[model samples]
Target: MSTGKEELEVEEDFPVVDQDEVVEPPAEVAKTNLAKRRTIDALLAEKRLQKELEDYPYDL
Candidate 1:
């Protein structure tokens, strides 16, 4: 009974510690993400231009 209590106490004293790890993206994955980002940017720019054209005043 005393040994069991001691084991529990030891476990309580030392909690689990998490180790953070920095993972780097692979080259092919990085390239794919960059391509997707560029496509999204182009689409957004086109939408912005269309909005501006609609809002432009043609009363010159």
Candidate 2:
């Protein structure tokens, strides 16, 4: 009887999770992430241009 009670308690302690309930990023979140990536890319490109100008000041 004690073992059965312990089993029931253990089962009740853990809630069941449904596989179908997945967490998805919102559209706004995706857009924000894209914008952030673009900003980072732009910054990197600007830095590269500065480095290139420093290396070849006479070319420009």
Candidate 3:
């Protein structure tokens, strides 16, 4: 009995995995970060408009 060939089959019922369990983040923390990103985007858009108004040569 010296055979070393082993075959194993693995099957999962629930294929979906929760990413948070592997690298968890608090709910409030994630929400706050999303809010901050939105605020930053708004500020960037405002600055872009200001630059366009100043740089564009228009006869008024």
Candidate 4:
């Protein structure tokens, strides 16, 4: 008697990462990324404030 099951094969196109091999960015690059993020956040906050001001009723 044979088991009615077929083994499936899968091929991965990306490299496998090991938890031990994780690394952090260089200090300079990290600082640059942080600055960029802060700028983006400030712009978003300004946009939200502008929208709220537009929605506020000045006649009340």
Candidate 5:
């Protein structure tokens, strides 16, 4: 039971959609992302240390 209606064929419309396929980020993106994460981790660690230092003698 096949009516060969060309317009209904998926392959005909595939090329247009395929052309917009996602491309992986360039190497620089990985480097920058790593640096960004390191910077954030360092910042959070510093904040925690500062908060700890603030309660040196324990405000009891």
Candidate 6:
């Protein structure tokens, strides 16, 4: 039963947020997060390599 004009009017009632206005974490927090991410990435890479090696054992 709602019309298109009514939907458009409803959408205008909310305020829009600008990306620049968003707040960022403090430098120390950002650094900690980055370190944690790197550790996780390294662990994932190690696991993948181990799996690949197991799949194809080498004779030396």
Query: Local distance difference test, per candidate?
Result: 0.82, 0.82, 0.86, 0.90, 0.82, 0.86
Q: How many Å off is the CA of 17 in candidate 2?
A: 17
lDDT of 2 by residue, 4-59 (tens): 54534344578777878877676667889899999999999999999998888585
Q: Candidate 5: list runs displaced more than 4 Å.
A: 1-28, 58-60
Residue-level lDDT tens digits of model 3 in 1-60: 647686667876877778775865656788899999999999999999999999998986
TM-score, prediction 5: 0.49
How well is each residue in 1-60 modelled by candidate 4, as lDDT tens digits? 657697768977998899889997766678898999999999999999999999999997
For all candidates, the clash counts are 0, 0, 0, 0, 0, 0
Worst 10 residues of 4 by lDDT: 1-10
Colliding residue pairs in candidate 1: none
Q: Candidate 6: lDDT over CA atoms? A: 0.86
Q: For residues 1-60, what per-residue lDDT tens digits would candidate 1 score against the true structure?
A: 355545443445776555655555766678898999999999999999999999999999
TM-score for all predictions? 0.53, 0.51, 0.48, 0.53, 0.49, 0.48
Off by over 4 Å in 3: 1-28
Off by over 4 Å in 4: 1-28
What's the lDDT of the predicted structure labeled candidate 3? 0.86
TM-score of 6: 0.48
Q: For candidate 5, lDDT tens digit of each residue in 1-60?
A: 668765663555544456469686766678898999999999999999999999799767
**Candidate 2, residue 57: lDDT:** 57
Off by over 4 Å in 1: 1-28
